[model samples]
Target: MKKIAITIIKFIGFFLGWAILSSILPLSSSENQAIWRLWAEIMPLLAIIAFTFIFWLIEKKNIKLHLFDNPVKGIALGAITGIVWLAFPVLIMYIAKIIDFDGTNSIDLFPVWVLAAFLNVIMQELLVRGYLYQMLKQKHNIVVAAAVTTALFTALHGGAFEAGVIPVLNVLTMSLLMTVVLEYSGSIIAPVIMHFLWNGIGALVLDGVSLADDYPNMLIATFTGNEILSGGICKMEGSMIVLFINVILTALFMFLKNKQGTK
Candidate 1:
Protein backbone atom coordinates (compact mmCIF):
# COMPACT_ATOMS: atom_id res chain seq x y z
CA MET A 1 0.00 0.00 0.00
CA LYS A 2 2.76 2.39 0.92
CA LYS A 3 4.69 1.56 -2.21
CA ILE A 4 1.68 2.19 -4.40
CA ALA A 5 0.92 5.38 -2.51
CA ILE A 6 4.45 6.65 -2.94
CA THR A 7 4.41 5.86 -6.63
CA ILE A 8 1.20 7.76 -7.18
CA ILE A 9 2.36 10.72 -5.10
CA LYS A 10 5.69 11.00 -6.87
CA PHE A 11 4.13 10.53 -10.27
CA ILE A 12 1.58 13.24 -9.74
CA GLY A 13 4.07 15.47 -7.97
CA PHE A 14 6.60 15.32 -10.79
CA PHE A 15 4.02 16.27 -13.37
CA LEU A 16 2.79 19.09 -11.17
CA GLY A 17 6.32 20.37 -10.92
CA TRP A 18 6.58 20.40 -14.68
CA ALA A 19 3.24 22.10 -15.10
CA ILE A 20 4.11 24.79 -12.59
CA LEU A 21 7.53 25.43 -14.02
CA SER A 22 6.27 25.35 -17.59
CA SER A 23 3.69 28.02 -16.88
CA ILE A 24 6.46 30.28 -15.61
CA LEU A 25 6.51 31.63 -19.11
CA PRO A 26 3.04 32.61 -20.17
CA LEU A 27 1.69 30.58 -23.06
CA SER A 28 1.21 32.34 -26.38
CA SER A 29 0.12 31.75 -29.94
CA SER A 30 1.47 34.70 -31.79
CA GLU A 31 2.23 35.31 -35.43
CA ASN A 32 5.76 36.18 -34.41
CA GLN A 33 8.21 33.28 -34.21
CA ALA A 34 10.02 34.68 -31.19
CA ILE A 35 6.85 34.88 -29.11
CA TRP A 36 5.74 31.50 -30.37
CA ARG A 37 9.04 30.01 -29.31
CA LEU A 38 8.44 31.12 -25.76
CA TRP A 39 5.26 29.11 -25.73
CA ALA A 40 5.79 26.31 -28.24
CA GLU A 41 9.30 25.17 -27.44
CA ILE A 42 11.28 27.15 -24.94
CA MET A 43 9.11 27.07 -21.82
CA PRO A 44 8.56 23.34 -21.75
CA LEU A 45 12.24 22.68 -22.38
CA LEU A 46 13.26 25.11 -19.67
CA ALA A 47 10.93 23.34 -17.30
CA ILE A 48 12.56 20.00 -18.02
CA ILE A 49 16.06 21.38 -17.60
CA ALA A 50 15.09 23.08 -14.39
CA PHE A 51 13.49 19.89 -13.13
CA THR A 52 16.64 17.93 -13.90
CA PHE A 53 18.71 20.40 -11.93
CA ILE A 54 16.30 20.26 -9.01
CA PHE A 55 16.91 16.55 -8.73
CA TRP A 56 20.67 16.94 -8.97
CA LEU A 57 21.08 20.01 -6.79
CA ILE A 58 18.37 19.61 -4.21
CA GLU A 59 17.24 15.97 -4.29
CA LYS A 60 20.76 14.84 -5.18
CA LYS A 61 19.55 12.31 -7.71
CA ASN A 62 21.75 12.22 -10.79
CA ILE A 63 19.50 10.79 -13.44
CA LYS A 64 21.22 8.80 -16.18
CA LEU A 65 19.66 10.37 -19.27
CA HIS A 66 22.36 8.73 -21.44
CA LEU A 67 22.78 12.08 -23.17
CA PHE A 68 26.22 12.89 -24.58
CA ASP A 69 27.35 9.32 -23.95
CA ASN A 70 28.72 8.71 -27.45
CA PRO A 71 28.01 11.77 -29.51
CA VAL A 72 28.90 10.62 -33.01
CA LYS A 73 27.67 7.08 -32.49
CA GLY A 74 24.41 8.19 -30.90
CA ILE A 75 23.65 10.65 -33.68
CA ALA A 76 24.65 8.07 -36.29
CA LEU A 77 22.42 5.44 -34.73
CA GLY A 78 19.66 8.01 -34.32
CA ALA A 79 19.90 9.13 -37.93
CA ILE A 80 19.61 5.60 -39.23
CA THR A 81 16.82 4.75 -36.84
CA GLY A 82 15.02 8.01 -37.59
CA ILE A 83 15.28 7.50 -41.32
CA VAL A 84 13.94 3.98 -41.08
CA TRP A 85 11.17 5.08 -38.75
CA LEU A 86 9.77 7.49 -41.33
CA ALA A 87 10.86 5.69 -44.49
CA PHE A 88 9.20 2.29 -44.23
CA PRO A 89 5.58 3.32 -44.08
CA VAL A 90 6.08 6.53 -46.03
CA LEU A 91 7.67 4.66 -48.91
CA ILE A 92 4.89 2.12 -48.90
CA MET A 93 2.23 4.82 -48.93
CA TYR A 94 3.99 6.69 -51.71
CA ILE A 95 4.39 3.52 -53.72
CA ALA A 96 0.71 2.79 -53.15
CA LYS A 97 0.02 6.13 -54.82
CA ILE A 98 -1.54 7.59 -51.72
CA ILE A 99 1.12 10.25 -51.36
CA ASP A 100 2.73 12.47 -54.04
CA PHE A 101 4.93 15.52 -53.89
CA ASP A 102 3.59 18.79 -55.27
CA GLY A 103 6.11 21.56 -54.48
CA THR A 104 7.69 23.47 -51.64
CA ASN A 105 6.65 26.36 -49.37
CA SER A 106 10.03 27.54 -48.27
CA ILE A 107 10.13 29.69 -45.16
CA ASP A 108 13.03 31.86 -44.07
CA LEU A 109 12.19 30.94 -40.48
CA PHE A 110 12.35 27.21 -41.14
CA PRO A 111 15.54 26.85 -39.13
CA VAL A 112 13.77 28.36 -36.14
CA TRP A 113 11.05 25.75 -36.33
CA VAL A 114 13.68 23.02 -36.51
CA LEU A 115 15.31 24.37 -33.39
CA ALA A 116 11.94 24.51 -31.67
CA ALA A 117 11.09 20.98 -32.74
CA PHE A 118 14.44 19.60 -31.64
CA LEU A 119 14.21 21.31 -28.27
CA ASN A 120 10.62 20.10 -27.88
CA VAL A 121 11.73 16.54 -28.53
CA ILE A 122 14.66 16.89 -26.17
CA MET A 123 12.47 18.25 -23.36
CA GLN A 124 9.85 15.52 -23.75
CA GLU A 125 12.44 12.72 -23.73
CA LEU A 126 14.12 14.15 -20.69
CA LEU A 127 10.90 14.68 -18.76
CA VAL A 128 9.46 11.25 -19.46
CA ARG A 129 12.58 9.07 -19.84
CA GLY A 130 14.91 11.13 -17.65
CA TYR A 131 14.09 12.08 -14.09
CA LEU A 132 10.61 10.64 -13.61
CA TYR A 133 11.55 7.35 -15.19
CA GLN A 134 14.73 7.00 -13.18
CA MET A 135 12.92 7.85 -9.99
CA LEU A 136 10.31 5.21 -10.61
CA LYS A 137 12.92 2.66 -11.57
CA GLN A 138 14.87 3.27 -8.40
CA LYS A 139 11.81 3.17 -6.17
CA HIS A 140 10.03 0.38 -8.01
CA ASN A 141 11.06 -1.38 -11.23
CA ILE A 142 11.46 -0.97 -14.97
CA VAL A 143 7.99 -2.23 -15.84
CA VAL A 144 6.48 0.27 -13.47
CA ALA A 145 8.64 3.03 -14.84
CA ALA A 146 7.72 2.19 -18.42
CA ALA A 147 4.05 2.00 -17.62
CA VAL A 148 3.95 5.33 -15.86
CA THR A 149 5.98 7.11 -18.50
CA THR A 150 4.03 5.54 -21.35
CA ALA A 151 0.73 6.61 -19.87
CA LEU A 152 2.07 10.10 -19.19
CA PHE A 153 3.35 10.32 -22.73
CA THR A 154 0.02 9.29 -24.20
CA ALA A 155 -1.84 11.70 -21.99
CA LEU A 156 0.41 14.55 -23.01
CA HIS A 157 -0.68 13.98 -26.60
CA GLY A 158 -4.34 13.42 -25.90
CA GLY A 159 -5.20 15.37 -29.02
CA ALA A 160 -4.47 12.21 -30.99
CA PHE A 161 -7.75 10.68 -29.77
CA GLU A 162 -9.58 13.62 -31.34
CA ALA A 163 -8.52 12.22 -34.72
CA GLY A 164 -9.77 8.76 -33.74
CA VAL A 165 -8.63 5.38 -32.45
CA ILE A 166 -5.88 4.80 -34.99
CA PRO A 167 -4.06 7.97 -34.02
CA VAL A 168 -4.51 7.20 -30.36
CA LEU A 169 -3.13 3.73 -30.89
CA ASN A 170 -0.28 5.19 -32.88
CA VAL A 171 0.59 7.43 -29.98
CA LEU A 172 0.41 4.50 -27.59
CA THR A 173 2.57 2.29 -29.75
CA MET A 174 4.95 5.19 -30.32
CA SER A 175 5.33 5.57 -26.58
CA LEU A 176 6.11 1.90 -26.38
CA LEU A 177 8.55 2.17 -29.26
CA MET A 178 10.51 4.97 -27.55
CA THR A 179 10.60 2.98 -24.31
CA VAL A 180 12.00 -0.08 -26.06
CA VAL A 181 14.47 1.98 -28.05
CA LEU A 182 15.73 3.58 -24.86
CA GLU A 183 16.42 0.14 -23.42
CA TYR A 184 18.04 -1.15 -26.59
CA SER A 185 20.46 1.75 -27.04
CA GLY A 186 20.95 2.38 -23.33
CA SER A 187 20.71 6.02 -24.38
CA ILE A 188 17.90 8.54 -24.69
CA ILE A 189 19.74 10.03 -27.69
CA ALA A 190 18.51 7.25 -29.96
CA PRO A 191 14.79 7.92 -29.52
CA VAL A 192 15.25 11.72 -29.44
CA ILE A 193 16.85 11.82 -32.88
CA MET A 194 14.42 9.27 -34.25
CA HIS A 195 11.46 11.29 -32.97
CA PHE A 196 12.78 14.59 -34.30
CA LEU A 197 13.41 13.07 -37.70
CA TRP A 198 9.98 11.54 -37.76
CA ASN A 199 8.36 14.90 -37.02
CA GLY A 200 10.81 17.36 -38.58
CA ILE A 201 11.13 15.56 -41.89
CA GLY A 202 7.48 14.74 -41.92
CA ALA A 203 6.58 18.38 -41.46
CA LEU A 204 9.11 19.46 -44.05
CA VAL A 205 8.51 16.88 -46.78
CA LEU A 206 5.30 15.02 -46.12
CA ASP A 207 1.87 16.32 -45.09
CA GLY A 208 3.07 16.74 -41.49
CA VAL A 209 2.98 14.60 -38.35
CA SER A 210 -0.59 15.07 -37.15
CA LEU A 211 0.48 18.27 -35.50
CA ALA A 212 -2.15 20.85 -34.56
CA ASP A 213 -0.27 23.80 -35.97
CA ASP A 214 0.64 24.47 -39.57
CA TYR A 215 4.07 25.54 -40.79
CA PRO A 216 5.86 26.08 -44.08
CA ASN A 217 6.07 22.55 -45.43
CA MET A 218 8.91 22.30 -47.94
CA LEU A 219 7.04 19.78 -50.05
CA ILE A 220 3.43 20.07 -50.99
CA ALA A 221 2.41 16.45 -50.62
CA THR A 222 -0.89 15.32 -52.01
CA PHE A 223 -2.53 12.28 -50.50
CA THR A 224 -5.50 10.53 -52.03
CA GLY A 225 -6.77 7.24 -50.60
CA ASN A 226 -8.39 5.62 -47.62
CA GLU A 227 -7.64 7.18 -44.27
CA ILE A 228 -5.97 3.92 -43.30
CA LEU A 229 -3.20 4.62 -45.78
CA SER A 230 -2.94 8.37 -46.17
CA GLY A 231 -4.02 9.24 -42.62
CA GLY A 232 -6.48 11.82 -43.94
CA ILE A 233 -6.54 15.04 -41.94
CA CYS A 234 -4.43 13.45 -39.22
CA LYS A 235 -1.38 13.19 -41.47
CA MET A 236 1.30 10.45 -41.54
CA GLU A 237 1.78 9.83 -37.85
CA GLY A 238 -1.92 9.06 -37.58
CA SER A 239 -1.84 6.57 -40.41
CA MET A 240 -2.78 2.98 -39.67
CA ILE A 241 0.39 2.02 -41.46
CA VAL A 242 2.45 4.10 -39.02
CA LEU A 243 0.71 2.39 -36.11
CA PHE A 244 1.65 -0.97 -37.58
CA ILE A 245 5.24 0.10 -38.11
CA ASN A 246 5.47 1.35 -34.53
CA VAL A 247 4.17 -1.98 -33.26
CA ILE A 248 6.71 -3.91 -35.28
CA LEU A 249 9.55 -1.67 -34.13
CA THR A 250 8.41 -1.99 -30.55
CA ALA A 251 8.41 -5.78 -30.77
CA LEU A 252 11.72 -5.89 -32.61
CA PHE A 253 13.38 -3.71 -29.99
CA MET A 254 11.90 -5.80 -27.22
CA PHE A 255 13.41 -8.84 -28.85
CA LEU A 256 16.74 -7.10 -29.15
CA LYS A 257 16.68 -6.12 -25.48
CA ASN A 258 15.77 -9.63 -24.37
CA LYS A 259 18.45 -11.13 -26.54
CA GLN A 260 21.02 -8.89 -24.92
CA GLY A 261 19.71 -9.67 -21.39
CA THR A 262 18.60 -6.12 -20.60
CA LYS A 263 15.89 -5.74 -18.02
Candidate 2:
Protein backbone atom coordinates (compact mmCIF):
# COMPACT_ATOMS: atom_id res chain seq x y z
CA MET A 1 0.00 0.00 0.00
CA LYS A 2 2.76 2.41 0.89
CA LYS A 3 4.67 1.60 -2.28
CA ILE A 4 1.59 2.09 -4.39
CA ALA A 5 0.86 5.40 -2.69
CA ILE A 6 4.37 6.63 -3.32
CA THR A 7 4.19 5.52 -6.95
CA ILE A 8 0.90 7.36 -7.46
CA ILE A 9 2.26 10.50 -5.81
CA LYS A 10 5.37 10.42 -8.00
CA PHE A 11 3.31 9.81 -11.12
CA ILE A 12 1.08 12.80 -10.34
CA GLY A 13 4.10 14.94 -9.56
CA PHE A 14 5.81 13.98 -12.81
CA PHE A 15 2.81 15.12 -14.84
CA LEU A 16 2.43 18.23 -12.73
CA GLY A 17 6.02 19.08 -13.46
CA TRP A 18 5.42 18.44 -17.16
CA ALA A 19 2.37 20.76 -17.12
CA ILE A 20 4.37 23.50 -15.41
CA LEU A 21 7.26 23.17 -17.83
CA SER A 22 4.94 23.14 -20.82
CA SER A 23 3.39 26.37 -19.67
CA ILE A 24 6.64 28.12 -18.81
CA LEU A 25 8.98 26.87 -21.54
CA PRO A 26 10.08 29.40 -24.11
CA LEU A 27 10.25 26.75 -26.81
CA SER A 28 7.25 28.23 -28.62
CA SER A 29 7.16 31.69 -30.20
CA SER A 30 4.00 33.16 -31.64
CA GLU A 31 5.91 35.59 -33.83
CA ASN A 32 8.22 32.96 -35.36
CA GLN A 33 6.68 30.26 -37.49
CA ALA A 34 9.93 28.28 -37.85
CA ILE A 35 10.57 28.25 -34.11
CA TRP A 36 6.99 27.15 -33.41
CA ARG A 37 7.31 24.27 -35.87
CA LEU A 38 10.57 23.13 -34.31
CA TRP A 39 9.01 23.27 -30.86
CA ALA A 40 6.04 21.27 -32.06
CA GLU A 41 8.33 18.46 -33.22
CA ILE A 42 10.41 18.38 -30.04
CA MET A 43 7.92 19.24 -27.30
CA PRO A 44 7.28 15.64 -26.28
CA LEU A 45 11.01 14.95 -25.97
CA LEU A 46 11.52 18.02 -23.82
CA ALA A 47 8.59 17.05 -21.61
CA ILE A 48 10.04 13.56 -21.16
CA ILE A 49 13.38 14.98 -20.12
CA ALA A 50 11.72 17.13 -17.48
CA PHE A 51 9.51 14.28 -16.29
CA THR A 52 12.50 11.97 -16.01
CA PHE A 53 14.34 14.39 -13.77
CA ILE A 54 11.28 14.83 -11.58
CA PHE A 55 10.81 11.07 -11.36
CA TRP A 56 14.45 10.55 -10.52
CA LEU A 57 14.13 12.99 -7.69
CA ILE A 58 11.08 11.15 -6.34
CA GLU A 59 12.09 7.53 -6.98
CA LYS A 60 15.78 7.18 -7.65
CA LYS A 61 16.15 3.42 -7.67
CA ASN A 62 13.15 2.22 -9.66
CA ILE A 63 13.66 4.17 -12.86
CA LYS A 64 15.07 1.88 -15.58
CA LEU A 65 15.53 3.74 -18.83
CA HIS A 66 17.72 1.10 -20.40
CA LEU A 67 16.60 -0.02 -23.86
CA PHE A 68 16.37 -3.81 -23.27
CA ASP A 69 18.24 -7.12 -22.87
CA ASN A 70 18.76 -7.81 -26.58
CA PRO A 71 18.06 -4.62 -28.48
CA VAL A 72 18.48 -6.19 -31.92
CA LYS A 73 16.06 -9.02 -31.26
CA GLY A 74 13.64 -6.72 -29.49
CA ILE A 75 13.64 -4.25 -32.35
CA ALA A 76 13.19 -7.02 -34.92
CA LEU A 77 10.29 -8.59 -33.06
CA GLY A 78 8.73 -5.21 -32.44
CA ALA A 79 8.95 -4.25 -36.08
CA ILE A 80 7.29 -7.51 -37.11
CA THR A 81 4.56 -7.08 -34.50
CA GLY A 82 3.94 -3.49 -35.52
CA ILE A 83 3.78 -4.34 -39.20
CA VAL A 84 1.30 -7.14 -38.54
CA TRP A 85 -0.96 -4.94 -36.45
CA LEU A 86 -0.80 -1.99 -38.83
CA ALA A 87 -1.16 -3.90 -42.09
CA PHE A 88 -3.99 -6.17 -40.95
CA PRO A 89 -6.62 -3.46 -40.68
CA VAL A 90 -5.41 -1.52 -43.69
CA LEU A 91 -5.70 -4.67 -45.80
CA ILE A 92 -9.16 -5.37 -44.40
CA MET A 93 -10.37 -1.86 -45.22
CA TYR A 94 -8.86 -2.03 -48.68
CA ILE A 95 -10.39 -5.42 -49.48
CA ALA A 96 -13.80 -4.35 -48.17
CA LYS A 97 -13.92 -1.62 -50.85
CA ILE A 98 -13.86 0.90 -48.02
CA ILE A 99 -10.43 2.29 -48.91
CA ASP A 100 -9.57 3.91 -52.22
CA PHE A 101 -5.91 4.60 -52.87
CA ASP A 102 -5.39 8.07 -54.25
CA GLY A 103 -1.64 7.98 -54.98
CA THR A 104 1.41 9.27 -53.06
CA ASN A 105 3.48 12.41 -52.56
CA SER A 106 6.28 13.45 -50.24
CA ILE A 107 5.55 15.23 -46.97
CA ASP A 108 8.14 17.92 -46.18
CA LEU A 109 7.31 17.44 -42.53
CA PHE A 110 7.77 13.67 -42.67
CA PRO A 111 11.32 13.73 -41.27
CA VAL A 112 10.36 15.84 -38.28
CA TRP A 113 7.26 13.72 -37.71
CA VAL A 114 9.40 10.58 -37.67
CA LEU A 115 11.75 12.10 -35.15
CA ALA A 116 8.83 13.16 -32.98
CA ALA A 117 7.32 9.69 -33.09
CA PHE A 118 10.63 8.10 -32.09
CA LEU A 119 11.05 10.48 -29.18
CA ASN A 120 7.44 10.04 -28.13
CA VAL A 121 7.89 6.26 -27.96
CA ILE A 122 11.06 6.60 -25.92
CA MET A 123 9.37 9.04 -23.56
CA GLN A 124 6.24 6.96 -23.03
CA GLU A 125 8.01 3.63 -22.60
CA LEU A 126 10.43 5.08 -20.08
CA LEU A 127 7.68 6.71 -18.08
CA VAL A 128 4.97 4.06 -18.10
CA ARG A 129 6.81 0.74 -18.46
CA GLY A 130 10.23 1.78 -17.14
CA TYR A 131 9.31 3.86 -14.13
CA LEU A 132 5.70 3.23 -13.20
CA TYR A 133 5.68 -0.51 -13.83
CA GLN A 134 8.95 -1.01 -11.96
CA MET A 135 7.66 0.99 -9.02
CA LEU A 136 4.43 -1.01 -8.81
CA LYS A 137 6.09 -4.39 -9.33
CA GLN A 138 8.33 -3.74 -6.36
CA LYS A 139 5.40 -4.48 -4.03
CA HIS A 140 2.54 -5.72 -6.19
CA ASN A 141 2.47 -8.70 -8.50
CA ILE A 142 3.12 -8.36 -12.24
CA VAL A 143 -0.60 -8.55 -12.96
CA VAL A 144 -1.39 -5.75 -10.53
CA ALA A 145 1.47 -3.64 -11.79
CA ALA A 146 0.50 -4.14 -15.42
CA ALA A 147 -3.13 -3.36 -14.64
CA VAL A 148 -2.30 -0.12 -12.85
CA THR A 149 0.16 0.95 -15.50
CA THR A 150 -2.28 0.15 -18.33
CA ALA A 151 -5.07 2.03 -16.58
CA LEU A 152 -2.88 5.08 -16.34
CA PHE A 153 -1.79 4.65 -19.93
CA THR A 154 -5.41 4.52 -21.10
CA ALA A 155 -6.31 7.52 -18.93
CA LEU A 156 -3.55 9.50 -20.62
CA HIS A 157 -5.40 9.05 -23.89
CA GLY A 158 -8.66 10.36 -22.48
CA GLY A 159 -8.55 13.18 -25.03
CA ALA A 160 -8.95 10.57 -27.78
CA PHE A 161 -12.27 9.61 -26.20
CA GLU A 162 -13.87 12.20 -28.43
CA ALA A 163 -13.08 9.84 -31.30
CA GLY A 164 -15.44 7.27 -29.64
CA VAL A 165 -15.42 4.39 -27.16
CA ILE A 166 -13.83 1.98 -29.62
CA PRO A 167 -10.72 4.08 -30.03
CA VAL A 168 -10.36 4.53 -26.30
CA LEU A 169 -10.79 0.81 -25.71
CA ASN A 170 -8.24 0.08 -28.41
CA VAL A 171 -5.76 2.37 -26.72
CA LEU A 172 -6.28 0.51 -23.45
CA THR A 173 -5.76 -2.81 -25.20
CA MET A 174 -2.59 -1.60 -26.90
CA SER A 175 -1.24 -0.35 -23.61
CA LEU A 176 -1.66 -3.80 -22.10
CA LEU A 177 0.14 -5.38 -25.04
CA MET A 178 2.98 -2.91 -24.69
CA THR A 179 3.30 -3.77 -21.01
CA VAL A 180 3.52 -7.45 -21.84
CA VAL A 181 6.18 -6.84 -24.47
CA LEU A 182 8.25 -4.83 -22.05
CA GLU A 183 7.97 -7.52 -19.38
CA TYR A 184 8.88 -10.41 -21.65
CA SER A 185 11.70 -8.67 -23.46
CA GLY A 186 13.06 -7.12 -20.25
CA SER A 187 13.53 -3.81 -22.00
CA ILE A 188 11.74 -0.74 -23.33
CA ILE A 189 13.35 -1.03 -26.79
CA ALA A 190 10.86 -3.55 -28.15
CA PRO A 191 7.80 -1.64 -27.00
CA VAL A 192 9.37 1.60 -28.19
CA ILE A 193 10.00 0.17 -31.64
CA MET A 194 6.50 -1.30 -31.75
CA HIS A 195 4.98 1.99 -30.63
CA PHE A 196 6.90 4.12 -33.11
CA LEU A 197 6.04 1.82 -35.99
CA TRP A 198 2.37 1.84 -35.08
CA ASN A 199 2.19 5.62 -34.81
CA GLY A 200 4.48 6.24 -37.78
CA ILE A 201 2.35 4.06 -40.01
CA GLY A 202 -0.83 5.74 -38.78
CA ALA A 203 0.62 9.19 -39.30
CA LEU A 204 1.73 8.23 -42.78
CA VAL A 205 -1.33 6.25 -43.86
CA LEU A 206 -4.32 7.18 -41.75
CA ASP A 207 -3.52 10.86 -41.35
CA GLY A 208 -2.52 10.95 -44.96
CA VAL A 209 -5.94 9.63 -45.95
CA SER A 210 -7.95 11.64 -43.47
CA LEU A 211 -6.16 14.94 -43.89
CA ALA A 212 -5.60 14.95 -47.64
CA ASP A 213 -7.46 18.25 -47.95
CA ASP A 214 -5.16 19.77 -45.34
CA TYR A 215 -1.90 18.10 -46.43
CA PRO A 216 -1.23 18.08 -50.14
CA ASN A 217 1.86 15.79 -50.25
CA MET A 218 0.26 12.77 -48.65
CA LEU A 219 -0.37 9.19 -49.78
CA ILE A 220 -4.11 9.39 -49.45
CA ALA A 221 -6.66 6.59 -49.24
CA THR A 222 -10.31 7.49 -49.06
CA PHE A 223 -12.20 5.30 -46.62
CA THR A 224 -15.87 4.76 -46.00
CA GLY A 225 -17.17 6.92 -43.13
CA ASN A 226 -18.07 4.06 -40.88
CA GLU A 227 -16.60 4.55 -37.41
CA ILE A 228 -17.27 0.93 -36.50
CA LEU A 229 -15.85 -1.00 -39.46
CA SER A 230 -13.78 1.64 -41.25
CA GLY A 231 -12.92 3.77 -38.20
CA GLY A 232 -13.45 7.51 -38.16
CA ILE A 233 -10.93 9.95 -36.67
CA CYS A 234 -8.77 7.19 -35.14
CA LYS A 235 -8.53 5.15 -38.35
CA MET A 236 -7.34 1.51 -38.40
CA GLU A 237 -6.47 1.26 -34.73
CA GLY A 238 -10.05 2.06 -33.82
CA SER A 239 -11.56 -0.70 -35.96
CA MET A 240 -13.15 -3.81 -34.43
CA ILE A 241 -10.93 -6.06 -36.52
CA VAL A 242 -7.82 -4.32 -35.21
CA LEU A 243 -9.02 -4.73 -31.62
CA PHE A 244 -9.60 -8.46 -32.11
CA ILE A 245 -6.19 -8.84 -33.72
CA ASN A 246 -4.55 -6.95 -30.88
CA VAL A 247 -6.14 -9.21 -28.27
CA ILE A 248 -5.09 -12.38 -30.08
CA LEU A 249 -1.56 -11.17 -30.75
CA THR A 250 -1.06 -9.98 -27.20
CA ALA A 251 -2.17 -13.37 -25.83
CA LEU A 252 0.08 -15.16 -28.26
CA PHE A 253 3.09 -13.05 -27.34
CA MET A 254 2.52 -13.64 -23.65
CA PHE A 255 2.14 -17.38 -24.12
CA LEU A 256 5.26 -17.71 -26.21
CA LYS A 257 7.30 -15.62 -23.85
CA ASN A 258 6.12 -17.59 -20.84
CA LYS A 259 6.97 -20.84 -22.59
CA GLN A 260 10.41 -19.55 -23.46
CA GLY A 261 11.00 -18.52 -19.87
CA THR A 262 10.19 -21.96 -18.52
CA LYS A 263 12.77 -23.58 -20.77
Off by over 4 Å in 2: 30-38, 57-66, 206-217
My TM-score estimates for the predictions, one after another, are 0.91, 0.85
Displacement of the residue 46 alpha carbon in candidate 1, Å: 1.0
- Please give the range of 10 consecutive residues that has the lowest summed lDDT in model 2: 208-217
lDDT of 1 by residue, 1-263 (tens): 99889768766777799888887767776878644763678888888888677765644555455666766766887899889989998899889998888777766677777777788889889988887887787778899889989988998998887888888898888988988888778778888999889878887557557443645577788778898778887778668899888988899889988998954
**Tens digits of per-residue lDDT for model 2, 121-202:** 6767766787567766765678887888888788877765778888787888899899878777777788888888777666
Clashing pairs in 1: none
Error of 2 at 1 (Å): 4.1
Q: For this target, which candidate reaches the highest TM-score against the unseen true structure?
A: 1
Backbone clash numbers for all candidates listed: 0, 0
lDDT of each: 0.80, 0.70
Please state every model's RMSD to the true fold in angstroms: 2.3, 3.2
